[model samples]
Target chain A: MSQLKTKHLLGIKNLDREDIELIFQTAANFKEVINRPIKKVPSLRDVTVANVFFENSTRTKLSFELAEKRLSADVINFSASGSSVKKGETLLDTVNNILAMKVDMVVMRHSSPGAPHFLAKHIDANIINAGDGTHEHPTQALLDSFSIQETCGQVEGKKVVIVGDILHSRVALSNIFALQTLGAEVMVCGPATLLPKHIRELGVKVETDIKKALEWCDVANILRIQLERQQMKYFPSLREYSNYFGVNKQLLDSLKKEITIMHPGPINRGVEITSDVADSDHSIILQQVENGVAIRMAVLYLLAGVT
Target chain B: MQKRLLFDSPLLKVTISRLCQQLIEVHGDFSQSVIIGMQPRGIYLAERIKEELESLVAKDIHLGYLDTTFHRDDFRRRDEPITPSQTKIPFLIENKNVILVDDVLFTGRTVRAALDAMNTFGRPAKVELLVLIDRLYSRHIPVEANYVGRKVNTIQSQKVLVELDEKQKEDHIWLITKEE
Candidate 1:
């Protein structure tokens, strides 16, 4: 008897081709269900899923809430704006209280990377890492893989460059690992201030040179810089960052017309990338957002053991 | 784009009919046996098989309904279903050949979930599978059905649709040529 089940999806590194396929299959079913007259399943009726957003999130938190509700799971959202986390309550204390309420699962997003993992050890409820600092957004990576598989056909042998804020983007870390695992040539490029020193340990080539990275890739996944978290005196200026690393029209023209551009939004337009580049025909960023729902639906169902 | 059927000249319906004959011979022992279809298309194929088997078998066999929406691998990515349809098995599947049925074999997640779904009901003596079309594509899991209706090699992006009059009011197998 193999211990092959998805009670918790903490990271993308834990997933294999089998796990990815399971997620894709689960999303495909829900995709069909949403097209019907009635889009709901009684599979998880009365099950409570606590959404702990210790940090700010728009698309991801709603996606998880929508996913949970679709499977008939009751959802309770806890955002930092009006939560005890801002009151300096310990993360463990808050989580333990949620556990005390007997929540079935905890879909958490925190400013710290290890937040979800920390909750996983402390709570009996399933812990799904919504987004944890700059560490890794596993589900985002998984959904991006699903979108790539759905649209681009395969992940293997595709030249995929992740441009912009590599230092503060969790999606970049997770996507790079997943893409390379599926046999894609991975490249990372950004301003020296935003890009990390060494990602080569993960077998990815780091390039401060943006034009060359774009030219050598089939897909360019743009990363958004965290505006609120940008410390003073780290980088020269936002305008300076935009001129060098931001994917403006001039930079976009360097790539082949067929090449696809992606961004894990809410994009800091004119800062890390231009508005035209983010909304161009080459951009699959919107597709990624749409597929986010389907992919997350797949993730929740798989982890919940729906089938 | 010139539309053409890449499969062998033999019709899919005829292939499914022949596969039915083979299944009747192999699992002819109707005792403790059940055929649960993986909805929404597999149910139609199973219904047809049930009709065919009723005429041949001496004993009345058990026909079960399975909607795998609840048993899917990705529940977080899509809109939720309001009432996940019931999984009704009239008779016990103890020490029986539980032949799971489906339309297409793509990434093997459906089959994977089916295996997981089976355990929730009861432990079966044996689990066999009969697929209408085996679209040879990327498979993440090592899963194969006991019986196959047709084997059509296709690209990863091809849309494989198995329509039934019961649901779509259209009965045919069609592949979508993806627009790049």
Candidate 2:
């Protein structure tokens, strides 16, 4: 239990309950480190990390970079838009070039599913999946769970309902694995077309009614409707989707108990959740962002011990 | 393996009292001074020392716990994974005399890491080291302690164990050696 069970954090599916707990424990320490007057440590001073993003990202990319820098590790960022990735260069070729520069780890976000998994099989360095298509965003899910544990004292036996475009979200998939592993009850509530056909096989309760879902859960994690990923309209319109599934302040106020609200951002404000609910005291959206850095720091630090 | 008692309970008590007397003489009233205990093992010794010092001076003293796991030199080079403890410094160390406390000072690496970790709080007016047991001739670094309870000559592969009981009567320091 001193080190991670796996060398790389490919996804939540690859991690067990103990691994998640270890990350949370380690992240707790890093949380203190980040809050200090001098919010930096030299644990990874000699190690170099390369953030290779094949897809566009804002928060995840920035969070990973900030986490790497806070650990005092050397960081090199690469996005597909400006890099040689646009000129017909392959994923392995780009990563191999970065590895050639003595990178010890790679934090990657790719548009294709299992890209990090593929790179892990070929590369010698550690791989952390930032986000891979609709596959899994391991760190995001870890941070979400960590935030839940921080707010609720623990994730065990808590009911968490994820409401949004579940079919196209890497966040929902990873969250289901992570929350379930930590002994939380999970439910996915969205339009029937937005939910995968076999999502019930994953052991989460499916509820299409947002009201019923909110009433049954202790926490409601609202997700954005990703228009970029949608090839065709899964729902009739954004207004229709929000009317049905969006978690508003009025909806939360009507609940028997005040359930914690969460959203993994680039939030389409007023779409998945209204401005009032997003800024409400019940929401932990900002805490989730802050915890992301610590969680990533813990992941990098723990994985660094393996090699 | 063999265990040899270095300091029994009575001797340990006398040593702690003597260390407190020396600290009192130098930093009268301890107005501008603070005590920090290194994490994991050093905290118990630090707590005992702080309690004893408070009772002697009849004044409150600032004490903090610092964990240097993130500043260690052997981070990726160590055989075992390094787990971090809590660093809870409620008061500022800026322009204050800071005394770093640890039970055993071995290769001087932990102290070195502690010094580095202390800088994150604020620059101290003066920094000093206090150790209950100093393993002489074994330091990998050039750092030395300002206050030493006892110095014992030791070789590699030997271990020094400090067991401090809550009630103080069962406290013991042992030198563990491998049997040939």
Candidate 3:
């Protein structure tokens, strides 16, 4: 059997180019189901998936929930807010209790990084890291890869500049790894304090000016300026972050017509991205969200096959 | 559970080999001809046929499985449908002869629906239906098996079933009367 048969999807770096290619090929085979009216498969009918969400989300949770349903698997949602997890239920206790339920897979989105690794090491079922703290969100990266593949004929040799708070964005970290794997040269541009200390080692050039980053890139992925990053002493204020590193209409003008825009959702609207640029034709943020269901469907189908 | 016999016994090796030789002889040099199996038994039939053809030639043959459950008009009423098997037709089937393989030919509704579902994948040059047992009873749809293994003239009350060993315990065929 292929390594994919028993693999736990924890991050983008865990997958090689061959694995990504296999996933793309598998996703291509499933292209028909998405176009069909029924939009379901028997591949995962007998399987059960548990969506353990500890964060507030509409798009991510719904996409994952719909992905499980689309793959014909029984889906169960668990939120720490309403569940016993709110009352001092440890992560291990929660996972162990769910493990007792005999679920085949756990698609988890936790605010703490390395929690998925902890779960996969302990649980028998396969674990998929949806979004873990400000560390890595593998599925978002995959969907972004799918979206990039759709817009550009291929990701190879394309200059993709990711702009905004890099130190506190999991989507930024994941997207950088994914874009580079698909053969894109990535450039991260943001304020000095918001950027990583060792940004160059992360496989991309770092630019302080957003306009310069736009001029040197074909695709611009402007990350959300997570309001929570304000409390971390990364930057002085959101207004300063917006004024220095925000992707406004002026910087959007700096981008050539061929340059595209991408963002891993819940945009700050006027913070990291202005209202005009967020609603601009270059924005593939909504497309990324729509593709989330389809991409997650593909992941569930493949991972559930292994399960 | 109700386990009804569909066909007499597993098809003899000689019979399957002969069928393979015949397919090779009819469709000479299996390049453009593709076999699409209608699950869950047609898949095995297609595999056996492809193995025979591969022994005769040295080319990469594309094989696909199409589950006709969702295509049936009685889709919602079928309790719960399984996720259809992967259809691995990497190349578009614009001008290829799509030989659809199935195990039993009863009401012909399955083949009729299979054809309807195949159109969504791509337009094939031609479509030919193959069946292990061609039961000439309950012809609700105008589907005729072009390639038939056995044509049993049975009453509508009787039933025929086929089982393959690829993913099952035993390979056999049996016939039985309706339980009701």
Candidate 4:
């Protein structure tokens, strides 16, 4: 299985173990390429990609743009804030307009779930779902798993606990799918209100206690508490949430063994995780950022081969 | 399919030594030169040559592996997806002579891609091609190896296979022709 099975990267749920392995293997090569003096490649030189973000993003957007540029693809970024979407242009119309301009690929992030899937059915170009509301961020999960594999030697059999709001986090959802597919034991640790009702149906262990979850896992992937997505309060307050569920150096140090730490960024320094733990030696937060580029490159490169 | 032995183990060993000798004669201790092997199959030849050259010249010759999967012109055109190997060039090629090594030079496309791949790692003072098997009259691009092991005339249906093994005695080069 040298090639990816699917044409578009809509979600990790659509991928099998072989696809994930191929992406990681290819990403390993891209990782080496990005570390070189000249970090750019001519692979996607003839391909044009449009980064159509229906929502705002910082790291994912920058990472995708950097990955596209490094692959030598011509990129045009579109955000919803100032776009024709504000003028009541439909999603299909906006994408069709971009496609008419001869765009070969679209990396889209929409506020609604399955937006990329919707566009995939209508558009001829390849569609990479950057983030579709609370659905999934495939690249983030891939890079997170890649980082784990890089650090701990493998993702198989390792205990990885995702610590934070799982309901509103596309990162958590994608991470669970990717980690499980790669044969890792996954556990979601957060307050009861933040976790979705049927999260156990996804086959991951659920734990409301942060310390017990920390003690049981080899790696902890801390997620940000999305205040913007919360219309009503899930937890009492930020201070109380931090008091119960926050991961700090004291909590980590209290563990029986030193476990690897991870956080998909825009980290709440003292809210979900403290400054010391975020910047600690156990943290692979920064490496995740770097791996994001390589993972995205591997995805774009592989999908470009589909036609 | 028909297979013909182009070079046996003994011949391969002698050819490699001769190639290393020619390299030593030109590079002269390789103080300002680096050997870069094209990825996938080329690294084996590059490793063998680097080992032979170091022992012959009694100098540590810097060697690197380069993958041209990203630079290939036939990228979306090929039926099978091109998988990239690792590119491990630790040192910069600035103002240094680069000897690009490969096992087979057939369509000249891999070498062309290698040329583009090598350019990313600074500008080399001089770049030279070294191939174990040169498939004559089969180039799609203008690429000629500086050090050629054996030039064998081949048709479009013919393929050159250079097998370099850990056990040096098992090394053999074969010309395979597809029979319809």
The sequence of per-residue lDDT tens digits that candidate 1 reaches over residues B91-158 is 67767889898878888987887776666566789999898778775688888778987787778877
For candidate 4, write residues A1-307 as lDDT tens digits.
Answer: 2799999999999999999999999999999889988899998999999999999899999999999999999999999998899999999999999999999999999999999999999888999999999999999999999999999999999999999999999999999999999999999999999999999999999999999999999999999999999999998899999999999999888888999999999998899999999998999999999999999999999999996
Model 1: residues >4 Å from true position, as ranges? A1-6, B1-67, B71-180
Of candidates 3 and 2, the better by lDDT: 2
lDDT of 2 at B65: 98
Sliding window of 10 residues with minimal summed lDDT for model 1 chain A = A1-10
Q: Judging by lDDT, tell me the better candidate of 1 and 4.
A: 4
Candidate number of the best DockQ: 4
The CA lDDT of each predicted structure is 0.75, 0.94, 0.77, 0.94
Interface RMSD of each: 12.0, 1.5, 8.6, 1.4
Q: What is the lDDT of residue B172 in candidate 3?
A: 74
By DockQ: ranked, best first: 4, 2, 3, 1
For model 4 the local lDDT of residue A146 reads 97
State the interface C-alpha RMSD of candidate 2: 1.5
Task: Supply the DockQ value of model 1.
Answer: 0.06
lDDT score for candidate 2 against the true structure:
0.94
Which stretches of model 2 miss by more than 4 angstroms? Answer: none
Over the stretch A1-307, how does candidate 2's per-residue lDDT look in tens digits?
3888899999999999999999999999999999999999999999999999889999999999999999999999998898887788999999999999999999999999999999999999999999999999999999999999999999999999999999999999999999999999999999999999999999999999999999999998999899999999898989999899888888888988999999999899988999999998999999999999999999999999884
Enumerate the candidates' DockQ scores in order: 0.06, 0.69, 0.08, 0.75
